[model samples]
Target: MSTPSPTMPPWPAESDHASGWSLVRAAAAAAEAAAAANRPARYALVAATGLLRELAPEEEGGLLAWEPGTGWRCLLPPQDCRQAVADLYLPLCAAHAARPITVAHLGQSLDGFIATGGGDSYYVTGPANILHLHRLRALCDAVVVGAETVLTDNPRLTARLATGPNPLRVVLDPSRRLPATHHVFSDGAASTVRACLAPNAAFTPGAADLVVAERGGRLDLADLVRQLRARGCSRIFIEGGGVTVSAFLQAGLLDRLQVAIASLLIGEGRPALMLPGREPLAHCVRPAARLFRMGEDILYDCDLAASTAAPAAAAPNGQSLQRLF
Candidate 1:
């Protein structure tokens, strides 16, 4: 619990307390504004701390503040702010302030399947995880998904469940196979980018931004990140169906990877990650992680960038895990 500040004034009578969701919305607004100005989003949050203070009046006591260097902390007591909310989100806020970040997230069963063999993946986690995904979209400048996800789900890729602006939608369809009629390409809810290896003449102008990547055996992931960054999408979210997220991870492009493990089991289906296997446990990628319980789901928020930058640590015995690629 946080203690009340002796010197700070109480919250205004007109705005006594703010709901956690309200704060989430406010943070999203700040991030959106920051992206528009091409500045680190955390600066906006810092500038608005005074305004946020009103949500947690000194008398009532429960305030949360996030800094790039120090991370999240309470300025006043009772620590009324929801810890789960802060734990789940503050890293994202910090990521915005630190540098351009590429994050990938997936929800899977305890057995590691994202869906059944027949492709039925309606609710792997619970409502809370779904809302968390929406919050992820709300906080990012762009949300990416592979062609299979588009063909399978036809998702709108909007932050409809959360109180924030919809993110720019990006579809990773290397072959340009997804039809223009999909909701992401046709709905016009937000600007959409169709990234492919070749331009499809069938797509009409303004249908969506057509980004033709350099022709390799596959789309160049690094070049793709550069192009997206050039377009001012500094915070990218890879919301996916495994293969695409795995590709980014293998290419060492992901800054963070979040996987929500549900209590149920799919027994056998598509795996959550498809990385090459390491014969020894010490050779596996061991990222720094923080865990959060969301209803029935357990989210393992892995810090890939931190793990990759730091020196490899010794495992349980004398052996050390392989350095992240």
Candidate 2:
């Protein structure tokens, strides 16, 4: 979808005009009516006529719904809506509903570099994408990153730019090399999880809860996922420094992948994704991607699971081997 117009307001604004106030009152009334009827109501306010009218069944658009405690909420049609704002919320809601959905996101340059060779990745994308990341963190139950990201960026990983509770911070440090002085550890704004390969006896986490899931001196990604699931993290957002993201993708654990490409080109730097596979072109992943613009950056959302080839035929035993795609 095209980018939202620059002149459009971030949200509906209150104005001294009577028509604006009437629209607000109509919306409130519609929400209450929907709540009383135990169903959502759809209405559109015509600016020229200054009237709020119920949408017909054939009409194709989003609606404003009302919940008892929560006033009014926008309900957009996932497949029908062309609004750029819908691009952000629809995927997020879909992930939230799934059983432990995992999404990996990265902001890279035109040349596919996530950071400079020196590891200076600050402002790789525009300010809008940074806010978009915050929105993702707000929606997810947990946000994960690698030890190198923690050391290099020292990000707070909180939802400061968005409206919602901050998700739990997860640091994958197989060697426990990250220090306790990082902003994610010392910020105290959100709960943190430190997953390492070493046993509890070998190391102590600084300010975050410690989780040791080691198998052959490596942090088991599947085990880590189970731990997060046990903690009621239904949706996990993996924000990274290459290796961590690569590990998840290699494991075929990611449900969705969103890559935001910036306008500038960083000739040499850290790559965004690095899956090691020597499969032929036909066997390679070719997820159906959709594009959206977030300020100057172009966001590509890929559905990994759906885009993979279908499962092979079952064996003579009437059992099919489960595939991870």
Candidate 3:
């Protein structure tokens, strides 16, 4: 329910209305052109709006306008543009229509990761990225990590910014990596799910609701996706170490890769993207990609931008799907 702008000139002729792919294309073309030029798409929609002028419905109305990132939105009764993008993404993402998931990587040094080192592995990315990441978290429906990560790092697994309900916290404990005595079980009464290897394992009050099940070989991956989707999780964020990163990449299930490289890379510290074994790059993972920089590190945002040749899936220590989400 939006307030209609009385000042809006009525939509044009019936001949002008874009009801099918034609109209969608027009809107998308307009949006894309405008965004590319760093200009507003307002004028484009205005031009398209005239198509229905012929209809001149007794109650003239219909149209929506707003920037995607910035929520400056408005409606004139009948038309709503805010919902257009998702629709657009659907067709645009037909082959890759998994959902607009993003993996936010917080690279750390040997000293510590995310302000958290061996002794003090508190936080990895700084305030800015942390803020941005929280915003991302709020935008998503779920957050994930692997089990070993839980053993080592007792993360609250909660979105602390961009307030709203926190994303559901998920753990991929393939082998029941998290003991019933783990902190995740003791933390606030937050919504959490632990995917374990033993499907019928008895649960303790602390970790009673764990999703314990043995994933069948290559099928474990499918089960993971199905479980999350069943939870109504459309957008996922994987934020963790290397193993998971390599897993998703190798599986070719990884949709997007967003890695933030800190200015100070502990040259001698841990390696990022743990795919295991020194395989020849020619036979390893490949993805089509791009880069952006925030603060000191560069953000490598890849959309299957790596090599077409898949890498041999290897689960190394600290390497878990937790990183990809």
Best by TM-score: 1
**Distance from true location, Cα of 61 in model 3, Å:** 15
Candidates ranked by lDDT, best first?
1, 2, 3
- Estimate the overall C-alpha local distance difference test score of candidate 2: 0.69
Per-residue error for 198 in candidate 3, Å, reads 1.3
Flag regions of model 2 displaced more than 4 Å: 1-82, 96-98, 199-206, 308-325
lDDT of 2 at 307: 84
The lDDT, on a scale of 0 to 1, for candidate 3 is 0.49
TM-scores for all candidates: the values are 0.77, 0.71, 0.57
Residue pair clashes in candidate 1: 2-77, 3-77
lDDT of 2 by residue, 151-186 (tens): 888899999976567989999977667778888777
In Å, residue 150's CA in model 3 sits off its true spot by 1.9
lDDT of 3 at 84: 28
lDDT of 2 at 290: 59
- Full ranking by TM-score: 1, 2, 3
Predicted structure with the largest lDDT when compared to the true one? 1
